[model samples]
Target chain A: MKHTVTLILLMLFFAVPAGVLVLISLASGWRFPDVWPAGFSFSGIALFLQQKEQILSSLASSFVFSLLTVGVTFFMCLVPAAVFARNDFRGKTVLEGLLLTPALVPPMTFAMGLHFFFIKLSLADTLPGVVLILAIFSYPYMFRALVAGFQTMGEHYRICARNLGAGPFSILWQVELPLLMPAVVAGGSVVFLVAFSEYFLVFLIGGGRVASFTGLLMPLLSSSNRSLAALLTLIFLLLPVGLFFILDLSLMRSFRKKGMA
Target chain B: MSWTNNRAGRLVSGLAPLLLPYLVLFCGGIMLTICQSFGVFTPLPHAGAALDAYAKILTDPAFFSSFGFSLGVAMVSAFCTMAAGTFLAYQVWQLPAKLATAALIYKIPLILPHISVAFVVLVFWSPSGIVASIAHSLGIIQTMQDFPNILYSGWGLGMVLAYTLKGTPFAMLLVLALLVRFDVRQIQTAAMLGASGVRIFFSIVLPRMAPAMHTSFIILFLYGFGAFDIPFVLGESRPGMLSIHVYNLYFKHDLARRPEAMAILTMMFFFAVIFIIAYSKTVQRLENGVRKL
Candidate 1:
């Protein structure tokens, strides 16, 4: 009995939302008093194809910025993460907690002030500005992940590399980085998702000059065109899921090659 | 002493890449906000006193109402999401390994952006939405319009539902992380000792899950409180969320009201800090008291 109830709920929780989205995406004029969509058509798909350039460019822009954020955050967190993982120093705990504050406080709180500053610095409505704000907002996730990654990896590898007379850059690039792939991927995935799905930050700082998928999707969501909105939303959902799937697959394959799996 | 100074300098320089941006952006942004809140460095010249913005915001009934509404929505949604997540996670944990793996389907909502979740709620619960259509077909409602206005009932139920949907999976993920390491022997031993299922859950399982519950509650509550995405989609104009109010004043209003907007942001920043301190202290006290018991 318990199993049956859980199964039913599991279905309800996952299936209903996805099922509704699929139906709406294919639906043509699904109207009042209709239990199911009235007519399933390719009109939404047709419209999507027609506006493919605009939609796809926005998507590509979002993808590019999100990846750039991942890179920026990775660089930003690397040395600090190493320092944090290896060293015990004065005020370390307090400083670490303060660093993690961005994750806790809503981005909206600081975004306005950042927006004001960005404008003065001529970074507003620029791609770099969007990426910078996103990196600042999200680098904490990478910082935390890399700290854990370094802890799990321990001092042995770095010590071994040093004893082998490896320079710092060489050790970081060749020895440590290869082992740190999983952590980077894990942290990068999160940073990517946070950056990709972000609506307000991109919209405000981008000021509509910078194109983003969320920027394109937000207005369509509230509009009367349900099918197109549904279609775009599915794309929004699938992109990250696809990226994670590929990431997991490649990580597994590489780990298996190294006999680490 | 020179060697020690050199080591310290190296440490500081090593951390400079991360610290530089953080200090320059996060701390800098906050400092700028405080300054602007005091009617300094705003877009326009402030001829008024430093406290003018605070006075206007504090005296306004709408600001208070918005604050209250945001608080109520956040608290209620966080509680509901936590309850549902804990219960469901417990259930999943109890399932057979094969089935438990399948139950990972619950995480579908986690990858979804907040706005997408809002879209899902809007698509399902609106008057002309799928739920209403189903009700009409089933004779529960005579017409689609006869369906209740669940989305815009003036209670922020739409935002609550959206938050719960998006947050439940997150809560489950956190709890399940802890639960995966939990020993089943404790529950088995309790069960054998003639404890009812409810008693075992409350006594044994509840304590195990408490840390995650508190963490997720704070997280989801704060996100719901200050987050603009979900609210922007589901929120009403009158008595809007605090984030929405700030957004409007910052963007939609005149340049002079920027100080007022900054004032609200500064207040929220302090509130968040106090909330974390107060919450952790209270949790610490409660835990210590429980240990004594």
Candidate 2:
């Protein structure tokens, strides 16, 4: 009974807004003093269809930068995570904490300065610049995850691979990576989400030259057009949520194949 | 000694690639912000004292109001999220395994962006929104305007609601992670020892959940303080969030005022550092060496 109450309340809190969003997407004129939407129409979805090219291009742009961010963060964190996992030194904790500070502090603190530096280096208003800034801010998630992954896998695997005459590159590629899939997915998921949902940094760095879903959606959201805002929001939610669903299934299948399910 | 020296050298070389970027980007970025805050590296030339920007911001009542408003929103939302998250996580942990698994719907909000969450709050809480409609239909209000103004109430109630809605799921995820490894038998044993529910919760459950709670609180608090998406959608202009303040200063204004904007950023960065240090120390002293997360 208690569980049932909790479930209902949780649904009310989390799911009802989604249901309302769907309703608003179809709502033609939902005015005050009405318990339900006054009427429904496909106008919102039709508008989306009308702007298909723009929406798709924005989607593709968001996808490209987010994927690049994840890839860059993965490589950047790889050697550092391994080193930190295997070795201990003075100030390890302090360094780790410092490394994680980017995740904790507001991006506004450093973003303005970085903006100046990027312009000087001729990286502003470019996709690679956006990817680099996103990776810098979001890589800590990947780093922390990989560190935990290495901690879990332990050094025994590395020793065994070395004893079997596997070189460092082969051991990293064949031995470590296969075992670190879960961590990679975990970390990569966060990096993807952070990069995908990020608006200010992308807008600042992309400088209106790069089209992004968020850049398109944020302005529409602030407008009084509930129907249009709702439709775009649905699209915004679908992309990363869709990605995570695929990720979860693949991770599950891999675990099953490894008989670790 | 020589062998150890070689190992250290290898470690240093291995770490150099990562540390180089960290130093250049993260550390260099902060150094640049400080320099610009003092009017050193701005595009506009200035012959004023280095402390000019700092003095201007310090004397402005607008800055303090924004700062206080942001602090209030962050603290309130974070506290509510942690409290609600702890209660719900405890309840979920007590459920049978299958039901507990089904309760993963809480992760739904974890997937939504702050902007989307802001939209959700706006759609439901605005004067002529769903809540007002419902209230009017239920005879609680004669018209939509009779519903209390929440989104633009000047107290940042809308931002708080959105942040809490978004942050609760995150807090739950963190707290639930700790609960998964927790031994349920302890709760059962306490119950068998004639301990009351409240006592068991306060003494047994809370202490175990402290690490996740503290971490989530700091994370959510800082995020709420610094985030721009929700406030952009739901915030007002008079006493804006510091992020909104910075946005106006950097983008809306001319290049001459960039140093003042940078000064605010530098101060916020220092405050973040101080917050982390004080929070960590307080948690450490309270827990006395118990670290779960």
Candidate 3:
């Protein structure tokens, strides 16, 4: 009983930052020295809703970038994993080592290099430029997960998939994909979260012309209208979590209907 | 065989769009920046080739200080984090099976936003922050104002502490992942064969853990070296950490010397990649050694 109470309390504590942010977003004021916000309001909510267009555009960019990242990550791990699982290649060990290299390197430093390159290519200030710089550069965890999935899923599944008279596309869509989904979902979130919260590269490469949520928050941080910043933080932070939940639900439900879940 | 080839081709075709973007991102972008570092920062940058940028940046006294400071703090923090993280992981590892879910709960900070982390550090470590408040209440300090201003001291010790707190759970999580798959039966048998717990751990578990520890150290070091948030909000403005300095050169200064900054960034990237390669090799070597043993 004691352990159960402690566990529940600990879980509650774990969720406080996000919960506080949500409360602040809903509340009209959260002045310092108060244990809680003064009260809740929808007046400020309307103003935030008014900023929806700007938010939507940035959100759209975030989605597109995330999709591009997930796609790249899936394949980068897929090819080598396929090769490695089937038969040995020369320098196989070295290629395996090289594949994991992206995860070990610091992102900001990598971002800096990409920023420089993008500037030279005249892509530095554009979405494609940011995409080229930011997408799938450092995601070793994803590689580890996907490669393990592909290797372990093996030749038998493919043969079985073929024997079912399932076309290659159908086999991939129906068979390999279901097995890979958990790895992809798990890997995808790690990459997506890192990219979403990523500060240096996006800011530098985007060159202030591209106003991301984090980028937009930069000016207000100097002033720190605590209530407002907290509200903005809540909203900005939840956007990713919210999208992820919706995706998870839809994916799970779709899979469940198809008896894949 | 044709069907297999056809299927493989389809897989490749399906995968191409995803793979191509990363190639352009990582390879093209990185090499371009590295090459641009040699180029003069013409507004066009197409004017090309400036040894001057490299020479001038290398010659800057402040640049060297910042670089050393960044590297040194990272080293200090990484070492400290490894110790604390190992201890914490051990403590968590000893938990009852029923409380395994609760053990995972102790690791909330690993998933906590970096901004919240910065905020927490600010709130706790500021002289007018939590520590000061506690000391004042204890009569150890007359006022919060009289308490030490650890955050902006330029020594980066406080910032490193904050970084360690933010980083420890992550290191611990990685350690936990390794420990989950670990075979403990032999270690127990060794304990039954008259080995002390400490000896079994040092001889058996530590070697088993070396690769993951090395990977963790590299990750912690990289994170510290390129840490932008904790340092940005906490470090003194004049202290000139490398990332901070590069940022200033780009945005605040808005100079044509972006290429100069790029030169430093390229050096950073080179060292980072070298470290990654070395760490990966060490892990591979350790894995092979373990397998052989």
> What is the per-residue lDDT of model 3 for residues A1-261, given as tens digits with 9 covering 90 to 100?
645554554454345545655665577754433345568887556765777687667766766765666666666666555555566546757766755655555566556656655666788778776654555554566767776677777789889889979997888787888877877787777777666665566677777666566665544444534445555666655666677779899888988998866
In candidate 2, stretches whose alpha carbon ends up further than 4 angstroms from where it belongs are: A258-261, B1-5, B279-293
In angstroms, the error of model 3 at B180 is 0.8
Q: DockQ rank, highest first?
A: 2, 1, 3
Ranking by TM-score: 2, 1, 3
- The TM-scores, one per candidate, come to 0.95, 0.96, 0.81
**Across the candidates, what are chain A's individual TM-scores?**
0.96, 0.96, 0.81
- Can you list each candidate's DockQ? 0.68, 0.71, 0.32
For residues B111-223, what per-residue lDDT tens digits would candidate 2 score against the true structure?
77788888899888899888888888788999766889888889999999999999898888888888887888999999999999999999998988888888888888998
How high is the lDDT of residue B12 in model 1? 89
lDDT of 2: 0.87
CA deviation > 4 Å runs, candidate 1 = B1-7, B278-293
- Model 3 chain A scores worst on lDDT over the 10 consecutive residues at A218-227
Please report the TM-score between candidate 2 and the true structure.
0.96
Candidate 3 off by > 4 Å: A1-64, A75-81, A84-87, A106-122, A231-261, B1-23, B40-50, B190-203, B254-256, B289-293
Whole-model Cα lDDT per candidate?
0.88, 0.87, 0.67
True contacts kept of 3: 0.34
